[model samples]
Target: MDVSQRLSFFAALFKVHENPTTGMWLLYITIVLLSILVFKLGFAKKLPIIKSAVIYTFLILGCTVLTFLGVFLPVAEGLVVAALILIIYKIRLHQEKKEQAKAE
Candidate 1:
């Protein structure tokens, strides 16, 4: 890639300038999995099996677009940070609830 294209951290890391197919696939999978993790940790709610299936379907489809941007941006990195924050929040919330229950 040219100097400008290499500005994408993951693109350079994945050697996209050398191998486009492999790099693109790696970026796509990374983005999709991270997107699902972020969704489950921060936004998902209980639903019927079919409803959940539909939601996942759309989520997977949505990740396709994200994959393109991910190659040129920190999309996966951002999602990772978001997922970590949500996970920490959930852990703290759980602990608070446990402490309250014991006090009660």
Candidate 2:
């Protein structure tokens, strides 16, 4: 298969193979930021400072692996989609609650 065809969206956008260090780091940062946003918006629950720190530390470590997978898979793209879906769901949920409050 063609290399261009196999590269993931962010990978191709950053030209990972062409720029090696810079591109890979940029791709990795993109994946990490997206993953953190998704986790905060969709999955995180309030936690104490230490616990939150630990969780994020592990999450960043996990993103390193994700960065590798993201080169060929749509991992970052999937995270972006997931984050958008969560944002929409949260907005709708908040509106419903507000409407119910007003009706009460």
Candidate maximizing TM-score: 2
lDDT of 2 by residue, 1-104 (tens): 67877899899999987887998999989988998999999899999999999999999999999999999999999999999999999999999999999999
TM agreement with the true structure for every prediction? 0.88, 0.95
RMSD of 1: 1.8
Q: Cα deviation in Å at residue 40, candidate 1?
A: 0.5
The residue pairs that clash in candidate 2, if any, are none
lDDT of 1 at 28: 80
Candidate 2 local lDDT, residue 5: 78
As a TM-score, model 2 comes out at: 0.95
Candidate 1 segments exceeding 4 Å error: 1-7
